[model samples]
Target: MIVSDPATPHRREGFESAPDPRLYNDDLAPTEPIRRTWTTYNYLALWFSMSMEVTTYMLASSLIAGGMNWKQAVLTILLGNVIVLIPMLLNAHAGAKYGIPFPVFVRASFGPMGANIPAILRAIVACGWFGIQSWIGGQAIAQMVAVLAPSTTGSPVVTWVCFLGFWALNMFVIWRGVESIRFLQSFSAPFMLIMSGLLLFFMLHKAGGFGPMLSAPSHFATHSAFWHFFFPSLTAMVGYWATLSLNIPDFTRYAKNQESQLVGQAFGLPVAMVLYSFIGIACTSASTIVFGRPIWSPVELLGEFHQPFLAFLGLVALLIATLNVNIGANVVGPSNDISNLAPSVISFRTGGLITGFLGLAMMPWKLMASFGSYVFGWLVGYSGLLGPVAGIMVADYFLVRGTQLDTYSLYRRGGMYEYSKGINPAAMISLVVGVAAALVGRVMPLVSFLYDYAWFVGFFLSGALYFVMMLGHRVRRSAVVS
Candidate 1:
C-alpha cells in the first residue's frame, strides 16, 4: 500500500541494492533496522564469539590429542579457515544487497514450493544446538555455583532444573526478536574482549612463557597418523564454519555494504578466529601446566583459579560470550530459515519460538551418549548438507541465474518461481542425490576410508547435479522461446 519511490535517495542501489522488489513484502523486513554500523570490528567480534566457545576448546584439544602434533593441527586450522572464507563472503554479499535473511534467498534456486527442504533441515539442526548450547551455558553457572557452594550435591534434578532455566532465558531473548539479539551482541562483545585479554594475561603468567608451551608436546606420532587426525578435525571445523556461510545473509543483510561485509569477514574469520584459537590453545595449555592435566571446558578451567573475585568475573564473562556465540551463529540463522517456509503464516520470532520449544521437547540429553558424541557428530552430518546447498545455491546464483534473484516471486506462491506447478524437481532431486553421496563419504560405515573428504565430495556432487539440471532447463526454454 505504501511504496517508497524507487528513485528516492534512501533506496539502496548498485550490487548491494535490492534488485528484486519482492523482498519488500509487508510484515517481512524489520522496521528501523540498524544501518551498516557493523564494521570490521563487529564482524571480528562475531567470529571471535563463534570460535571462542566450548566447541572450539574441545576441537583444539581433540586435534592435539588425536595425534595431529600441534604443528599439524595449526596448519589444518589455517587451511580450513581459508577454505570457508570464499563461500562465507559470497553469501554475505547476498545479505548486503537485499537485506533479507538467507532462506528468503533460497527461493531463487529451490523455488517457492520446495525451498522448505533446506530450510527445515537447517532449522532442525539449529534447534538441537539451541538446547545443547543452553545446557552448556547452564553448566557454566553450575560450575560457578559448585565452587561457591561446595557442599551442595550436584544432582540430576538440580542440573536439569538449571539447564531448563537457562534454556528458557535464551528463548525469551530470542522471542524479543532480532533487535534484542543484535543488542545483546553489541553489549556483550566488548566485555568478552576485555575478559579474553585478562584470560590471556593470566594464562601466560601461569604458563611462565608462551613460547615454551607452544613447543611442549612430549610425544609425537607418525606423519600419516598426524595427517589423519589433523585433517578430520580440520575438515570438521571447515564444515562447522561453512554451516553458517549459507545463512550468514541473515545477519549481513543488516551490514552497510559489500565492503563492510568483507571487512567483517576479514576481522570475523582469520583475525578474530586466530585470536580465539590462540587464546583457547593458551588456556588449555596453561591448564595442563598448572593443574597437571588438560581441561576442555572453559568453565572447568576457570574452576581451578584461586582468587574468588577473578573466578566470578571470568565465569560470568565466559558464560555471556558462549551464549552470545550460540545465539548468533546457531539461533538467528534458523529463525529466519524456518520462518521463510510459510512467510504468510510465520514471522521470524514465531519460528524461533517454535523451534525453541521443539528443541526442548526432543530430550536432547538422549543425543549425548558414551557410544560417541552423537549430538556433535550428527551436527557434522547436518553440516555436510550445508556444503552441497551452498554449492548449488552459489552455482545457480552466480552461474546459471547470473546473480539476479527474482525477489518478488520469493513471497508469492503462484508467482514467477512456480517453475513447474509449485515445485522444482531438479532442485529437490539434486539435493537428495548430493546429500546421499555426502552421507556415503562421511557416514556410511562401509566407506569409512573416504570419510575425511565428505565436504569436498558433497560440494562437487551438488554443483554438478545443479549445473546439469540448469542446462536441461535452459535447453528446454530455448526450444519454447524460439
Candidate 2:
C-alpha cells in the first residue's frame, strides 16, 4: 500500500557534519531541511524578549530591595551574567557544533543511558517553572480584567475564569508548535519593546530624572544590613538568570554556524539584560513617586492607571512577554528532554503540551503567596548544581574526550553513557554530594551564613567529586584487566 520514495535523501545523510542533527530542529524533521536557518538578529530579538518581562523586572527590584545602591546592584547583575557566561559559551559551542539539545549533548559526558538522569532532572525543573510562570501570567491577566470590569472583578469565579482563559490561550499557541511559537515571538518581542519605551517615557515625565530615582533610596540605617541584603539578592538575581545560561544550547543549536552563536551571545545576553534592568529601575521608581508606594509588580503598577484601554493593552503585552520567556528559556529545553526519554511515544509537540497542561493545573499563585521568598531561595540553591554539571561536562568534552563525541552511543543503551546497569554512579554521586553540601547551610540555621554561596560551593563539589570518582573507576577497571 505504501511505496517509499527512492530519490528521498536519508534523514541522517543530509545532516551537516554535526555530531547530532536532532539539535537543529526541536527533534521534528523540517519538511525541507533548514540550511540557512537563523541569523544574529533573530538571537538579539530572542534575548530582548527573554529579558523584557515582568519576572526579570521583579528580580532586579529585589536586588535593589537587598540594599545595594544602583551602581552596586547593576554590577552584581553584570557579575552574575559573567559567571554564567562560561558554561553558556561552552554549551552553545557544543550545540552549534553538534546541532542538538542539551539533553542529547550530555550523552557525551554522562553516557547514553546515563544521560537520562540529567535530562529527567532538567525536565522536572522546567515543568515546575512552566506551571509557576503561567500561573503568574494568569494572575496578571485576572487583575487586569478586574480593572476593566469593576462590577465582575470581586467574584472569585471571574478570577478563575480569567486564569483558565489565559492558560488555554497559551496552550493553543504552544500546541501549534515551533512555527507558531516563532510567529508569536515576532509580535511579542516588538510589542514589549514598545511598551517598555512607553513606560520609560512616562517615568521620565513623572519622576523628573534618572539620578533622583537611583539615589532616592537612603532608608537603610546600617551599612552591614544593607550589604547583607545586597549580596544575597545580587546572588539570587545571578542564580535565577543562571538557569538560562545552562540551557542556552536549546536555541543556539539552530544557529547557522559557530560565529553566529558567539555573536548572538555577545550581543544578545548582556545588552538586553542591562536595558531591561534599567527600565525596571525607572518604572518601579516612577511608580513609587506616582502611586506613593513601591509597587513591585508591573501589572500592579499598570493596574493603578485610570485608563482601561492602556491597562488592558499593558496586560496583553505582559502576557505575550511572559509566554515568550517561559517557552524559550523554560519550556523548549524540557520538552526536548521528555522526548529524549521516549522519542517514539513522545513527540516534541506532545511533550510541550504535557508541560503546558501540567503548568496550568498546578496553579502557582498559592505557592507564591505562601512561600515566595523560601521558594526563590531554594531555586537559587538548586541552580548551583548546574554550574558543577556544566563544568564537568566542559572538562570531559574538551579536556578528557578531546571534542569528539560518540553520537551513536547516545541511542544505544549500555554504550558510551551507561556505566553499571544503565546508570552512571560517578555522575550520580557528584550531583547528590554537591547538592547536599550546597544546602547544608540552609537546612542548619547555625551555619546559614554559608547558604548564599551555594552556587559556587555546588559547582566546585560536583566537579571535584566527578573527576575523582571517574579517575578512581578508570584505575580500578585497568588494574582488574591487567
Candidate 3:
C-alpha cells in the first residue's frame, strides 16, 4: 500500500521503511514522485541530442554507400526508427508507472538475482558504445589540434593525447551524475540542431542544390536485388537502436508521467532520426560532387575546408554532439546496470568509472575502422543479443503483469519475484531460445536471413515463448497503490 504524506503528496512511499540490504541501495531505490520532474520537452531534447551524432551520420551514409539512393536510405532509417519506437515506448511505460530503473523493474520477470544476466549483457554493449562515441569525440579534438598546429598532423601521440583528453571529459560528466546529463542534453539539443542545419546549408551550396545532391541513381540492378538488400538493411537499422529499446526505463523512470515519456518519444525519436539522417545522406551525396568522391566521415569532410576557423567550428559542434550522445545514451543504463550488481558495494559513479575503463579496453578504434564492420558486424550482431531481452521485458510487463508491478516486492528477497532462488527459469530459457533462433543463420548458411532479421525473429519468438511458458504460473498482483 502507498502511504501518502500530506507534506509530500507527490512522493510515492517506497520500500524505504525497511528494504532488503542485499537487494536495495539508494541508487536502485524507486524514485519519489516529487523528484520525477522530467517533462515532455526533456525527453524530446534527449532524443534530439542523441540523434545528432557522428554515428547516426555514418549509419545513413553507409546505406547510401551500400547501393541505395538517398530517398531509399532515408526511408529505411525512418521505418526502422518507427518500428523500434513501439518497443521503446512499451518498456518506458513500466518505468514511468513504477518509478524504478530498468534493473529493479526487470526483477519482476527475471528475478532479483537473475536480473543480473540481462543487466550485465546490456552493460557490456553500452561499454562498446561508450568506446565508439569517445573515439569519435577524440577524433574531433585531434582534428582541431592538427588544424591549429600543422606539424602535429598524423602524429599518433597527438591522436592518443586528444583521445584520452576527450575520454576524461566524458568521465567527468558521468561523475557529476544523471542531472548533469539532463542539463547537457537540454542545453545542447537546439545548438546541435542549428549546427546540423548550418552543415546541411554548406553541403547544399557546395553541391549546387538538391538536384545534383540527390541525383545519384539506385545501384541495385534488379528488383530482387533491392528487396534482398532492403530486408537486412532494415534489420540493421532496427538493430542500431535495439539496445535502447530494452533499457529506456533508465531514463523514463524520472518522467513526470507516462504521457510525457510517450508523447515526447513519439515526437522526438523518429522525426529527429529521419531529419538528421537526411542531413547525413544529403551531405554525403553532396561530397561526391564537391570532392570528386563520396566522403562519408563528417570529420574527414570537415578537414577538406581550407579555412581553419570554419573547420574548427564544425569540429566543436561535433565534439558537443558526441559528448551529448555518449553521456546520455551510453553512460546512464550501464551505470545503473553495474550498480545493480552488489548495490551495497558499488554506486552509480563507480559503475560509470568502470564503464569508462572497459570502454578503453574494447579498442573501439578497430571497430570503427570500416563501415561494413561497424554497421553489419557490430550493430546487427549486438541487436541479436538485445532483442530477446526487449521481447521478454515487454511481454512480461504488458501482457503477463498488465503493466502493474509490485514495487515493494521488487527490492526484497523471498518476495513474489524470488522464483526458484532468485532466478526465473522461464525467462532464462526463453532468452536462450530467442537468441538461438535469431542467431541460427550465423552458423547455417542457408538460413542466413534469420541473422539479417535478427531483431524481429528474437523479439517475436522469445515474447511468444515467454507468454506460453508463463501460463499456469501464479503472478502476484501489484501491492503498491496507484
Candidate 4:
C-alpha cells in the first residue's frame, strides 16, 4: 500500500502472466468459510486434544526438574498459555477472515519472495519438532518392546527400528488423508486421557497418597534463585507453544467463526495446560517418592513398572498421544510452508515428505538429551527464532496493514506486495537482527541473562524495529515523490 510505483497503489492486476492456479486458487482464497460446520464444540475438542499431548506433559515436568516447585511450575505453565494467547488470536484473525495461511498472509508485509524468510524459519523449527515427536513415539514403542523382551529393550538397534516404525506410522496416516487423521485424533484423545488418568491413579497408589506426593519441593532455595529460574522457565513455558502461536491459523482457518477460535483457544489452552500440567507435576513428584529420585521421562517411568500388561497399555497410550500431536503440530505447518516454497512442483503431500526427511536429518536427539536440553535447546531456542516472526506478523497485520490485506495481490508475483524487487528490506533486516540477538544471548555468556527472556526480547524488539522502519520507508518515499 505504501510502495513507490504510482501504478502499485491503483494497479491491482497488471500481471504479465497469470498467477499459477497451483500457487493460489479457491483453496487458498478468502472464501468458503468452514463456519457452517465448525461449532464451538468442534473448536473446544480441537484445542483440548491439541493441549493434552506428550510435549505439554514433558514441558511441565521439565519445569519442575529445572527447579520450580510443583505449584510454581503449574502457575508458570498456565500464565505462559494465557500470555501467548494474545499473539495467537491476533495472527489467527487474518486466517479466519481471509482464509489465507501464514505464508501468504506474511506477503503483505514481507513481499512475496521475502515472505519465505519467516515461512522457512517456521518450517525448519517444525522439522526439528517433528523429530522430537517421532523420538517420543519411538521411545514409547521401545518401552513396549521392553515389556515383551526385557533383554532387547535397551538396544540402540531396537530403538532405531522403533523410531522408524513410529515415523512410518505417521507417514501412513498422513498419506491416508484428513478423514483418517480425524478418526485417529478422536480415538487417540479418549485413550490418551484414559491413559493419563490411569497413570495418575498408579502414581497415587505408589506414592502412598496425594498429600505426601504432590508436596514436591522447590529446588530453588533463595528468593533470588527462585526468580532466577522463574524467568527462564517462564520463557520456556511460553516458548513451548510459541510455534502454535504463529501457525495457529493453519487450524483456526477451519474455525466456524472468529469467536469459535478465540473462545475455544482461551477456554481450552489455559485449562488444559493447567490440568494436564497438574497431572505431570503430580506424577513427576510422585515419582520422586516412589523411585527415590525424579523420573521426568514418562516412557522411562512406565518401563519401570514390573507388570508387562500395564506397561504395554501405558506404552500404547504414549504412542497414540505422541502420534496425534506429531501429525497435527509437526506435519501441518511445515508441509504448508514447504509447498509455499515451490508451489508449482511441490504439492502438500510432497512437502510432507520433505518435512519428514528434514526432520530426521536435524538429529534432534541431542536437543532432547535431557529435560534441560529439551527446555533450553529445543523449546527456548526455537522460540527465539519464531518469536520475532510472530511479532512482525501481528504488528504488520494490526498496526501497519490495518488488519487488511489484498488477497489477490498476495498471489500476483509483481502486484502491490512486490515491494523493492520482491523483498521488503525492513522486514528482512528486522528478522535478522532479532534472531541474531537472540542467538547471541543463547551462546554468549556475556549476555546470557537475556536468554532467559529470549522470546519477549525478540518479539518486542523485532515488532518495534519493523514498525519503525516501515513508517520511515513510507515517509521517505512520500518526500522523494513530492
Candidate 5:
C-alpha cells in the first residue's frame, strides 16, 4: 500500500522529518534542491580528469600489447564505453531525481540492511582500485626521484616511502570533503589534456611519424583467435568503468538537474576515454618504433628520455592524473559505502581513512604485475561481481518502482523498504544467481564464454530475474503533502 503523510510539510523532501538514527546521517541524507549545484561542466571535468589517468592508458595499451592494432583497440574501447554509459545514465537518474547517494538509493531495492551486502562488495573493489592508482602515483614520484638522484632508482625503500607519501596525500584531500574534489577536477582536467597532447606529439616525433607509429599488424593469425580474444577484451573494457556505472549516483546526487548530469556524463565519459585511449594506443605503438620494443608503462617510457627536465614534467602530469582519478573514482564510493555500514558512527572522513588503509592491504603492485592479470584477471573478475548489483538496481528503480521513491521512508526503520526484516530475499537470490552464472565459466571450460562476457551476462540475467521475481510485488508510491 502507498502511504501518505499529508500532515508533514517536507514529506517528499525527506528533510525536517524525524528518521531512524541508525539509518540517517547528514552525509547520507537526500540532498536538498538548493544544495544540488553541480552543472554539466562539473561532470565533464570529472570524467576528463578521471579518464586521463595511467590506468586508462594501460587499459588501451594492454589491448595493443595483447594483439590488436591501434584501430581495433580504439574501437573496442569506444564500444565498451558506449555500452557501459547506458547503465551509468540509467543509474544516475535516481541520484538526480531523488538526491540520494548510492548507498541510500540502493536501500529501495536491497532493503535497508541488505543494502550493505552490495555496498561492501563495491567498497572492496574501490579499495583495490585505490591501491592500484596509489601504486601508479607512487611510481611517478619514484621516477621523479630517480631523475634527480640516479642512485635511488629501483630502491625498494624509496619506492615504499613514495607510495605511502602519495597515499597520505590522497587521505588529506579526502579530509577536506567532496567539494574539494570538484575544485580539483575542474582545475586539473584541462591541464591534463594539454599534457596528454604534448606527450602524443613527442611520441609521434620520436617514432618518425603517425604512420610508422601505428603501422603494427595484428598478431592474431585467425578470425577465431581474434574473436576469442575480442569478447573478453571487450568485457574488460566495459568492466573498466563498470564500477562507476553502479556508483555514479554518489556523484550525480549533487547535479543541478537531470540534463546537467546526463549531458555532462554523455559527453565526458566516452569522448575522454576514447580520445585518451587513442593517445595510449598511438604512443605505445610509437614506443615499439622508438625503443625497438613495446614500452607500455608511461613511467618507464618517460625514464628513457634524455632530458631530466622533460621527464620531470611528464611525471608531474602523471601525478596529477593519478591523484585526480584515485580520489574521485576510487575514494568517494568506498568512503560512502563504508559509512553506510554504520551511518551514525562512521562519517565520510573516517570511511575515507579506512579506505586508504585497506588499499594498502590489497597490495596493488601484484595486481598490476602483468597486462593479462590487470585486464583479464582483475577487470573482468570484478565486473562479474558488480554487474549483478547494477542489474538489480536498474531493474528495481525503473522496472518495479517506476522511479518513484518514498524519500523519507528510505531512512525510517519500519518504512516501505523494510521488506522481510530489512532484507529483500529476491534481490539477494538474484544477485547470487547472477554472479554464479557470470563466474561459473572459470571452473567449467565448456561455459567459458560466460566468464568472458561476465558483465553483460550478469547484468541481463540478474535484471531479468529480479523483474520476474518482483512481478507480483506491489509498488509503493511516495507521500504527498496536502
Candidate 6:
C-alpha cells in the first residue's frame, strides 16, 4: 500500500527518458502488489538454501577450533543470527511493501547517483565472495578427483582448471538469470537438508559416539577467556550475514506479502544457522576424537575420507551447497550493483559476467590466503563498510521517511532523491562517523578492543547518528499515531 504519488510526473530534468527501457525492466521496478508472487515458502527456501553452505560450515568449525566448546559455538551462531535477522527483516519491509530492490530502496536515503557509493562497496565485497565461493567449489571438485585419481590431487594446474570449470558453471546459471536461480533453490533445498543429515550421521559414526564430542571440555579454561573470544566471534558471525542483510531487498522485492518474507526468514535463517553451526562444531569436535586434529574446512576434511565413494559424494554435496549459496548471495547482489551503474547499458547478465571476471581478478585464494585474512580481515573488515551502510539505510527508511517512499522519484536524474545535488550530506556524514568509530582501533592502540566488535559498533553508532541528523530534516507526521 505504501507507494509514490502517482499524480507526480515520472519524468525529470536532464534525463528526459527516466528508467529507459533498454536499461529498465520489471525486475528492477517497484512491483505491483498483484505481481508479488513469492510466498512464505519461497523466502524460507531462500534462507535455507543460502545459509546451508561450505562458508557457513567453516564459520561454525572455526569457532569450535578457536577453543569454544560445542555449546558456546552453537550459542554464538544462534545469537548472532537472531540479532542480524532483525535488520534483515526490517530492510525487507520496503521491498515487500513497495517491491523495489535494495539499490533503489536506499536511493531514497543516499540519492539517485550517490546511492552508487554504498552499492559499490556492497558489490565489491560480493564480488570477492563470488571468487571465494567459486574457489571453494573448485577445491571440492579437485578433492573428489584426487580420491578417484590420487596422483592428480596436488596439481595446481588441476585446481585452476577446476576453478574455471566451476566458474563457467556459475556463469551459465547466471546467464539463465534469477528465475533459474529460483528453480535451483527449489530443487536444491531439500537435497541440502538430506545431505546435511547424512553428514551428521557420518560424523557420529566416525567419532564412535556423540557424548564425548558434545561434552568436549572447553579450551577457553576461564570465563574471561571465553568472553574475550565470544565477542569477536559473535561480531564476525554477524558480519558473515551482514551483506545479505543490506541487499535482501534484491530478493524480497518478489515477496507476495510481509508475512511471507518475515515468517519465512524467521523460520529459515536463525534455525538454519544454529543447526549448521552445530554441525560444524560437532564435526570438528568429532574430528579431534577420530583424526587427532580439528579440521575446520569441510573440503579438506572430506578429502581425508578414506572411502573414495563417500569422499566423492561429500565433495558433490559441498559443490551443490556452495552453488546454492554463491549465486544467491555472491552473484546476485554484485550483478544488481553493476547493472545499477548503467542500467541502459548493463543488463543483469552483463553484470553477472563482470562479477565472474572480478572474481578471477581478486584470486580469492589469496584473500583466503591466510587464516588471519579469512577470520579477521575479510569478514570483520568488510563489515565495517556494510554495517554502516545498513545502519544508515534502516534509519533513513524506518525513521526518516516512515517507510513511505516516492518510488517514481528514485529513477529520475533530479528529484527529491537528489538531495544536495544527488548526494545526501546527512547520510554520508553519518556513514563517515560510524565507519571512523569502527576503525579507530586501527590507529589508537588504547581503543584496539573496538576492532573486534566493528559491525556492532558501526551499526549502532551510524543508526543513532543518522536518526538525529534526519530528525531535523524529516517531515514530521501530522498528529502522530499512538
Model 2 lDDT per residue over 257-337, tens place: 778878877777777777888777667766777778766678778778887887788787888898888777777877877
Candidate 6's residue-wise lDDT over 269-315, tens digit each? 99888877788788888888879988888898888889899888878
TM per candidate: 0.88, 0.87, 0.95, 0.92, 0.96, 0.94
Candidate 1's displacement at residue 195, Å, is 1.2
**TM-score sort, best first:** 5, 3, 6, 4, 1, 2
| Superior by lDDT: candidate 1 or candidate 2 | 1
| Number of the top TM-score candidate | 5
List clash counts for every candidate, in order. 2, 5, 0, 1, 0, 2
Q: Which of the two candidates, 3 or 4, achieves a greater TM-score against the reference?
A: 3
TM-score of 6: 0.94
Better of 1 and 4 by TM-score: 4
Candidate 4 ranges beyond 4 A from true positions: 1-18, 21-31, 34-36, 472-482
lDDT of 1 by residue, 1-482 (tens): 12232122134323243423333333345323455456666676677767767666555655554544456556666777888888888777767776657777777788865777787877777777777677777777776776677654365666777777778777777777666666767778777777888987988888887875566562545666555555556557677676687888877777766787788786568665666666666667677788888765677788778887888788788678767877787788787776665566777678778877877875666654311253136544665677788888787777776565545445555755678865677788888877777777654667754456666667778878888888976665446446
Candidate 3 regions with alpha-carbon error over 4 angstroms: 1-17, 474-482
Model 3 TM-score, 2 decimals: 0.95
Clashing pairs in 6: 23-343, 23-344
For each of the candidates, the C-alpha root-mean-square deviation to the true structure, in angstroms, is 4.6, 5.5, 2.9, 3.8, 2.6, 3.1
TM-score of 4: 0.92
Model 5, residue 68: what's the lDDT? 98
Ranked candidates (lDDT, high to low): 5, 3, 6, 4, 1, 2
Candidate 5 yields a Cα-based lDDT of 0.91
lDDT of each: 0.68, 0.67, 0.89, 0.79, 0.91, 0.83
